[model samples]
Target: MTLGREDQPGAQGSSIQDGERDSPSAAIPRLETGIPRLDYILKGGFLRNGTYAVMGPPGSGKTILGNQLCFERVRRSSSARCVYVTLLVESHAKMIRHLSGMKWFDTGMIPDRIYYISGYTALRDQGLSGLIDLLRRTLRERRGTEVLVIDGLESVEQRAPDVLAFREFVHEIQGLSALSDCTTFLLSSTGERSHSENTLVDGVIELTDQLIGLRAVRELTVHKFRGGDYLRGKHEVEIQSSGMVIHPRTEIQFDTPQASATEDRKRMSFGIASFDAMIEGGLLSGSATALLGAPGIGKTLLGLSFLVEGAKQGEEGIYFGFYEPPPRLCEKARKVGIDLDTYIQEGTIRLLWQPPLEHMLDSLAEQLLELLRHRPKPRRRLFIDGIEGFRAASVYLDRLPRFLSAFTNQLRMLDVTTLVSEELDLFTPLIKMPSPELGNVVENVVLLRYVELRSQIHRLISIMKMRESHYDRSIREFFIGEQGIEVADSFRSAEQILSGQARLLAGLQDREGES
Candidate 1:
């Protein structure tokens, strides 16, 4: 949430203004935590001298985030100094030992750059007054103390005699931060902002680890970022060996995609001429297409053809899929004479294989977008095989509509022609659309089905819909000969083509009987 300059720190006339300098010529500076996407969520990191409360329950990664910030502060800047003061009696050695596994932890920065101390003794003996004096003296003793982390703010809160005293303690910490020109991070085990400590701080970053049904989801939210506007929502948060990795929600992140200036709305081919003829040459440039078919059908093969075609034309492409890795996927393409390995080796087409086990929807989208951003050229094609991979990875299945809509819209605006493959029932009498919103987001829908004709099974290809372009609707016999998928003549004599019960039309029957 964004706040006015008045409500935030580092402003000229802010309510909790930092230090004595109110010079008009000066600009409000920021202290980056050096964490990935944390600065992005903070809209250019936290205010330089701001006091932000990092609150969460136990085991919610609050401690890791706090320690990460500490190491990052010193790691990024040589002159940066940090002080980690924990009110809990847990030994700093144990904390250091626990953090040794993390990729960001630097052992050499101890004592000199980042000081680890205990506030438990001071808080227990002399109370809040004594703790405040200790911090004041520490900040003074360490001259370049730019970062201060109070690990057990909840302990300080519980020891306060009343709410007013707790608020006063927070206010005093804020004052000390401003006087010392330090960005303070108060890590507490209080997830809710019901206490006075939340509102008294410059910002509140909350991390929650909760079970949604059977799956445990960890989310991070910037409840209050006083200085500037941030992407407001529950973002995906993960704790790995490196540190915290955050993925801002797709819909919220690309709410307004930057419109590309390229007006080159040309057809993007799938390398198959006859199939291209059926869909009005090919899919319109910068348009999304839904390649819907049953399992074992040519859905995956068709997507590969599209990407391979782009790679042949010197246009960059990305194959973002879940099930098949690069090796297996290239082998599958080789069966159809689609030489994907050559283009892949030449750095024209990239095969991004993501395993379909326990993944985040936004993370996949961001990963694809990151790959796409590097290639600043037009005619960029993306083939997302097994679109259900996204559905499977999402916490809420209902969010697929909004997410796909935003995802495809952003790709289109970037002048990328996108194709997504979704599976249909193998042998059903009626075609069940995979999703209600899948067709709505795409500009074209290609239906591939198996038709039982004359006591034999045959594959038929047809274009169900193509927006803003005239497409051939005749159902053609789809065959996979030695050269790959070839679109044959339409089944003009057969009626009820898609129902798997095709019969000769009355006129064609009569003509056959007469002949």
Candidate 2:
């Protein structure tokens, strides 16, 4: 009798299968893991009836990932059963107690749709052969088991006398999974796998906990997937009470498409009329504008005004800040005659605040992407109050440029007019940017500085760069008052406004002398 399609080698239709011609409809059927982002990374989901290895060190979320998968499966299909065989001496009660904390864990499905069995006693008594026999008998008794998860494969490896014995044990489970059409998961603490063990599995997912300075970061990498194209890199993984959440690296999440044929030529206001005139009507739509200045130079206030203006125009705005909390920011806005609380209450604005410290760059990117994903309309205004905050959070300083480039490109693709504020050194006369490469990423640069004129401190704003747009280059005097940020005429009387100490121009000095 000819074997059915399901009985063929690589029954899940992995692309690695030799000489197998699968129809388009029969090509790599997938079973969703009930994880939205993980499903996206897997190109839909894991191949049905395929054996995969979830390899990671202890406390690296190996057990949680396995249990989450099992619970998700049983939750969807009441009749579908998952056999969870624990090979380690860890108590089943202890495992259940831990899983109970996750939101996805369902106590009603226990013992009915999901069965937990102990293989430790059997493996301890009769060795590798006994463990294999136990799995075979369990499969035979529990007919129609859709999923089989063997937790603690390292325990079985410990019992095996040699490498060959361990290989035999893996082969037995592989054969059992194929015969029963059961999707199998083998959990191992160590990332190391023998040649046979690696070749026998259809895919391998590795989880790691890395210490980058004082921060401990959790990352997940798809080391191998025989028939699938996964986002290849160290993607960020966060283990929360909800479950294991994976944040695919921003650099690889979306492909940068060619420039759109329909360009947005509309300009947006800065809410300060004179400031808008300096920037030539205002910033162009979808352009990235950098607000470069020292601390307390009205950078945050300008960003707030930008958001308030967008909110007034019925556009949605987001403020991703690191310095001040939401309430403090709202209070500050009120002091400047901008009502931020009203916009926030009306659902036109969102404030996301992360304290200044060592933060995972991927985590921040994920948070921003999550907010973008849930919004009903496209975000019109985005105020990243602290670009330097992201720079400080990055463990690898060299990668910051690439991250920013990807991030800015994504913002442009979404048609978001972005304002990123960078804190410059107050004492330094020479202008310093967070990164020199940033000049290439942004389309505009607005410089705010404190200039000393005859011992009196004054504030000035200038348009340093505006790509493909016309703007006033003259340094204009600005002030912060009860009406918020107000810009006046350029400091035409001074010669060294950019020097941080303005002196009278020779012509102006001569005119004053004549007077």
Candidate 3:
């Protein structure tokens, strides 16, 4: 039932090549994959009648994604026929069943014009002559098709009489694509070697895994797209019972608005007044802040406070913890009166326990991608209990900086006002450790430490850094309470406390109970 609008070939090329681009109406419509964020990457969609390849390992969702693309075109053009040719897998029935379950698919819109062919193995076994003959017939039969999907091209390569023969066969398919002027997709599972099939294809979408939590987390990246610009990053995706879900990439844009330094009271309480005051207010509603200190210095406690306070304000929150056990962390929050249990039960908060640092395999990019995918609220806050916990837990420390940069960019874009806690080296006098990637990425930094004065240990709070405000530099004594962190009245100490040294004020009483 395609509307039968054949795109004038010379016209599409001339308009684009003639050095003067015409409006979209004069050009052939780009092929769209129904996935919203995905469509954005494909640059107005795939070029009409272009050859595209999806290369990945087995179970990377190449075939499933291909099927989804076909359905997307069929749904959009209505008249454009979709022809799917299968080789290594039997996906037709499963694809149809899966699409049928989606709310977008109507009972009567069974895509009457759609067609498919299976048993490509026999054709491959027939050798070069057999493949050419089958290709000829398929072309003749599906000439009117606007879109074509060839699944498991690797199967053809495996059965070809020889390596050279397989390579030649791949070349022929590329030629066929140009002559037909029909958008096409080839599915391939590539190995470590240079893939002859990939070289022959006009575009390639690669899927791979990042070892995380003792399991491989799936990711996708577009290596090349001849006629379009795509987001250049390995994005996290998942194959659930419903179908393939793609998590779009997030990169920080310099144009993104910065938080105002104004003295506005839009502060988001972290349920700790002292911590909030050091930050010039609590965390901003749409700003990112870091609680940077050494291990066991209460970084996670600060993260929990942000979550607890945000939840109290009726805003949702998510804790992506890379270290602590879920139950243990939740219990700790409960003891502090943060009441995370109710938040979980009420669906206002989500606690995603990441694999222990050692078993975590996914890149920071992938982890961030997953968090956004399952985020519970549209306008929620995010808390990463400790970044160093993730670093200490990772087996591959070399990639840490890269992961952090990519992750920070994503968090800022999501506008979730992240609370990224990190553990630093306790022996160092510095309030915060410098992250090569997170350079100036943090909006504010709150430092917590144990300062000793006259044989008594006191918890000190310092406003190490605030990007947009003139925060008080005075170090203050603080106490952790059942209701959360409380700032004790200002430090009226006899000595300077920040450098681990102090001098008694001449008039200040050092005697017992002298204020």
Q: Could you estimate the TM-score for every candidate?
A: 0.91, 0.90, 0.69
Best by TM-score: 1
lDDT of 2 by residue, 342-403 (tens): 99999898899998876778678767755675463553889999888888877778877788
CA RMSD of all predictions: 7.1, 6.9, 8.2
Ordered list by TM-score, greatest first: 1, 2, 3
Q: lDDT winner among the candidates? A: 1
lDDT for model 2: 0.78
Candidate 2 has its poorest 10 consecutive residues by lDDT at 1-10
Minimum summed lDDT over a 10-residue window in model 1 is located at: 1-10
Q: Estimate the lDDT of model 1.
A: 0.79
Scored against the true structure, residue 288 in model 2 reaches a CA lDDT of: 91
* Clashes by residue pair, model 2: none
Cα lDDT for residue 491, model 3?
A: 72
